[model samples]
Target: MFITKVFILIIIASITNINNTSALKLECTYREPDLHWEAFSRDYTCEGTIRLDGDDENIRTVTNTHREQMRNADVRGLMIVQQRDLQKFPKGLERHFHHLIGIDFEDCGLTKISSDDLMPFKELLQINLSGNRLTELPNDLFQFNPKLKKIDLSGNLIMHVGLEIFNNLQHLTMINMHDNACTSDNAYATKKEELKELVWELSVECPPTLDMLSSSLFGSKEFIDNIKRISGEDSDDVRNELLNEIQGLEKIVQELKRRL
Candidate 1:
């Protein structure tokens, strides 16, 4: 669901009598005389907007719910800006925000990410991981985020992702994967076939998602074999076969829906 908090902020935005207006809206203001801060204006387009800020810190550090800086009311549309040591995926955030709607980790020097790292924020609609050192995406990357609508993975070292990493993101509309190592279909590249799988899943109609229901309904043998082949060799064949089945089933479901 689209967050009502943003609307509420917009409703009361004109109240000049309020002591703290920044606590209501989603805007980033930059300090003058700092050329580095000026760059943030260009980097984060939202910085130019005149909305009341969430009143978040200049550096949003989220380790746990107990942190003095982390407040429950300000969990929506949070941004962690320019923290170089935020290399590893910080756990326990999921425990705090049961349905975190928006998150921005721009230029935070992120190195890795896992499904568990985001599972806590299951209802996240937008996520920005631009400017990171990520190399490979896990198979279950979006296993927990079915409602995710937009994700920015630009400017990362991402090379490998499963054929089905995005198949289950039911509401995903916008995804940016630019400047990554896996943008090639050339066999000589790091993982050509894996990247090809991502391309195959770029668009769709009706239902627009694949999940356990389709997995159980089709390609049972290949799915079973792919599970075992991971421990052995020749996983590509089984994995591709199952992915093809999943894609095919999605089309069949769409076609069936059209007929009705």
Candidate 2:
């Protein structure tokens, strides 16, 4: 009888532990003006900032309670940090705090973000997405956030950035692209006037396309087969054919160069 009672107790404890692990824990704090000035000095507001910290379960599960908390706060800035399970921008925040002017999503494990994720934040003035795993950004990611003044994309794995990504961002003043995979001398710019020069430099360093003819010729099956035949056998006909092809290619190159 005692053994059966102990077995029942073990089962109850296991159930309790499982329930605790699955529970979402969300902590929201309202920052007053004195506490918000350091992080949002450029765009300080009387509404202050609402900082939200949560575990993986809290991040994945957005309940009506969470939405009510943010709605009641009505802050201009929203900060969510250290959510490792967050692989993309949480669309739930937009529904709860669409009037947010600034957002800080640092140290999240974000791998991808689309334009739709940010289209709702039309009043956004600044965004900080540093220390994530982002590899690329869409060209029209900021089309809706025209009032944006500062952007922080540092400490990510972004490898390529299109010049079109900066289009229509005339109000942009500061861009922090440091510690990314694609680092150019002009990647970090502080002034709005330097945006044009930055785009020109990035274009020179990372062109949008490669020489198609050269790339195709080197990777073609016919080119590989011809090379193997020339090296494996002593066929004078094959050797002469290759030499004539090389001479013709040289003449074409010379003609193209003359035109240039």
Candidate 3:
């Protein structure tokens, strides 16, 4: 009878412990930078935007959350940095989080990243930098992360992609850049039509060119599939037709601007 009672107590203790742990992992969101400073990792279950009125030192110290964790970190899945007015990003972010499969920094006010900042994560699968204020992308953005599978840099100010940039990322599957300005003057401002044309251009240009250059470029098929998946084009033939139409419209707009 005593053994039976002890087993029942042990089962109850396990159940109680699990309930407590699940309750502790509460998720929430905040807007102000001050709120994030105080509640950095306290509530890991949160998924709210940290909308900053302006840059603050308090907000910049988010790296401290990971610093303590890096002593014996084993994180997998996503890390999101949403809607924050960040003047600076965490240094050595990629080194410490080696197991990170994805990173999302959507709607954050990011201007530039040092070339060395994201070069260490050879195993990174996806990086989503949508809706930011990035102008010139780093030349060696994909050099270090050779195993990168997907990249989303939509809704930013990026004008003019050098041929060399995409040439390096051979294993890239999905690229979800919907609205991006690729003009030198306003790289951050992308029109709907402009985004369409850019997508078409990248799709047609990236396939044969990438394959011809690198033998290990495996994800070209998936990359093309990704382009079709997002653009809603049935096939390459339809994509080409759409591209021509958008290009024609763009040319007319350019001509009007020239006259003005």
- The residue-level lDDT of candidate 1 at 257 comes to 59
Return the lDDT, model 1, position 12. Answer: 76
lDDT per residue for candidate 1 within 73-145, as digits (tens), equals: 4445556666665676654444434445666777777788887777777667777888888876665677887
Expressed as tens digits, the lDDT of each residue in 1-260 for candidate 3 is 99999999999999976554432121223221322222223322223233332223222212223323432144433344665655454444434334555556667778865446666666666677777887655435677777766677778776534334555666655666556664232222134454445545743333222222232222245545656664874677767765665576557556645653
Off by over 4 Å in 1: 1-74, 184-198, 201-260
Index of the highest-lDDT prediction: 2
Q: Which ten residues in a row have the lowest lDDT in candidate 3?
A: 23-32
lDDT against the true structure, each candidate: 0.55, 0.64, 0.50
Q: Write the per-residue lDDT of candidate 2 for residues 1-260, one digit (tens) a residue.
A: 99999999999999977766654433455443454323454432233222233333233233233333344336577666777766756555554454778877778888977678888888888888989999776556787889888888888887655545667687888887778777653477876567666666655443322232233334356767888889998999999987876687667556645653
Superior by TM-score: candidate 1 or candidate 3: 1
Model 1 misses residue 235 by how many Å? 26
Candidate 3 matches the true fold with a TM-score of 0.46
Per-residue error (Å), model 2, residue 5 = 29
Kindly give the number of clashing pairs for every candidate: 1, 0, 11
As for lDDT, the candidate ahead, 2 or 3, is 2
Global lDDT of model 1: 0.55
Q: Comparing candidate 2 with candidate 3, which one achieves the higher TM-score?
A: 2
Q: Which residue pairs in model 2 clash with each other?
A: none
